[model samples]
Target: MSILRLPARQQVRVLLLSSLVMLAACGEKPQQAGGEMKVPVSVVTVEPTPTEVFVELPGRVEAIKEAEIRARVNGIVQEINFEQGSDVKSGQLLFTIDPAPYIAQRDQAAAQLKNAEADIRSARLFADRYAKLIKANAVSRQEYDNAVAQAGQAEAAVAAAKAALQSANINLGYTRVESPIDGRIGRSMVTEGALVSAASATQMATVQQLDRVYVDIPRSVNQLAQLRRAMAEGVLTRSAEGDALAYVLLEDGAEYEHPGKLLFSGVSVDPGTGQVSLRAEFENPDQILLPGMYVRVRLQQGMDEKALLVPQQAIQRTSDGLNSVYVVREGKVQPVAVSVGPQIKGSFLVYKGLNPGDVVVVEGFQKIRPGAAVQPIPWKQAGAKPGSQPGGPAGAQPEPEATPKG
Candidate 1:
């Protein structure tokens, strides 16, 4: 019965089977259709972030509160009050010179002052008697005038003695050398019994305040011009108050925990170095930042009024060694070569070849090819902080390494 069902095609099937066997013998797999292909990938979406763009240059660290402790009065060092390299507060005594001589001078002034007071008392009594006698005609006018003049001279002498006493007290206080700043003190230049002078060029000890420090950075004119141009051209956004943002980085690959302000920029350019001096201040509550520690500083060109940005991983170098990013469009991957200028937040400021709403592939970039379709997801959903994170693992990842970006 089955044979009868296949009867119409039995002869035709026999001839076709003979041809297929011959083709199989020629060594080829049969032509197939309805193939299933799937690619496993993590995808990220692109979004715009208005962040300040800046360049980082290597900088030298400095202390805002630094002082060299020197003696104000010439004397022998009688006491060393502080240990070397220890922290000291402002006005704290660090060295006590031989104060016996100052104390003797103070005592002599005190003795002189008492004598002046006794003389003034005697002269005042005589002057009062003479005034009464002069009116009663009991004493000659010249004698009465002489008594009054003696009282005036005694009063003047007392005033001069008091002034001398004050001066002596000040000199006595100066015998103790004190620190003018709160900071770590260096090794003492003069030990106990060593003679020091008020006019010594070398200091008795050096104290540098590290609690608050300054990092002096040199900014090039070309770099400043680039930033200014970006702001004027509306490439950089303005903050709510319209000021640009700033960031700092320390040596050993650490980003400063706090954001800094651009304190001031030198109006004059250095002819020798061809750079302008830029200064920024930071609070060092823990006193961790030391003076003379080299660091790096970054300054925003300006806020990109409505800047467009994308994940840095989305960018790639093409075979031609040009910057590029892969974007998804019409259910296919399209390679886009962009002119990326700088990074803002966790993304980059694309100068050309990309727009705000474009779907750029941030994840699975290595496996993606031209014309390949991808799934798009929100970038922030992966936990990216604008300008701070770039090419890092998505979602609460640590900030990317910012190495003096220009």
Candidate 2:
């Protein structure tokens, strides 16, 4: 029946029902369109690539050569020769001790030697005369033998006097304290007129060579074992010569200008710490590296031929210490658990739970959910050059990774 021909009350009721149906239809159409719309996200395609494997560890700086200047003889310090905190050469006079007593002893030894020489000459002349007389039967054989014995005793006295003189001279030389090495000397321990003794071996000063330095890093035994196993299993390949390069970060968070090389790995493990010592030599011509300074060292040990990596931003860390990333599969997002190794550049080295040709979400994380449709786009990092790869060598991290914590 036509609404116009119905009763007034019924017509009003029919019009209200029609209005409600039209409004419901309008809402349903928009809801269906929203479900069909896909969220746009930046992603990266995973591919196997070669990359250097390194570990960053805490290390201490040490001088390449160090020497303690000590008193070698007992004497009063007469003068301080070298300036405090100044460079010194080998054999350079650093301090002068009281030399008067040593000088008198040397003179006494010289005079005794001279007297002994005179006695030896006179005794030898008498022995020569007695030998001739005995041959001519003018002197008794016993008398000639006594004369030869006296000459031999005089010669022995002369030799003893000469040795005494040499000893005195050596003691005199010790009065002038000199540097044993070429290095920078620290403050003097004793001032002028201060008594120093050889018996106690009093330390006078310190000298250290700063042109080069050694960085000592300790690695846990477990880490060393893992690294060895990786190499043995062909998971990581070392350089042809088995050599490695080392770089350091200063305390101020600046990278050291010069690079260093591995010196040696200690064979014995430290009983107290359960760690092995590793030393690397670095050129410190500017003397920027001081002994006892703490630093972070990046040691490149091996290469990963077919390594998988993901963007640092893409990895999500949970409160339980688990790491995961969003991966797009068949135009849908899925959460995947991954085992991450040390961070390299701006990406993390993936050890597990990722495969080649996988698309990983790098941006628009908040808009994504499990099984949600997504429109993946190539991820472009801020400040990155054109055509640069995301989370690749084109980007860098502010700090090096501490491998132990990873």
Q: Which candidate leads the pack in TM-score?
A: 2
Please list the Cα RMSD from the true structure of every candidate, rounded to 1 decimal place: 10.2, 4.9
The TM-score of predicted model 2 comes to: 0.84
Cand. 2 Cα-lDDT: 0.86
| Residue lDDT tens for model 1, 304-376 | 4454566667778888878888877876778887877655445666677876677777777666678865655
lDDT by residue for model 2 (1-406), tens: 7889999999999999999999998778443434556999999988987777777888999999999988888999999999898889999999999999999999999999999999999999999999999999999999999999999999999999999999999999999989888888999999998999999998999999888999999988888877877788777888654678888988787789988999989999999999999999999989999889999998876877777888789999867878889999988999998877777777887877889889999999888779999999998878988765544422223222223211
The CA lDDT of each predicted structure is 0.72, 0.86
Residue 404, candidate 1: how far off, in angstroms? 19
Error of 1 at 363 (Å): 13
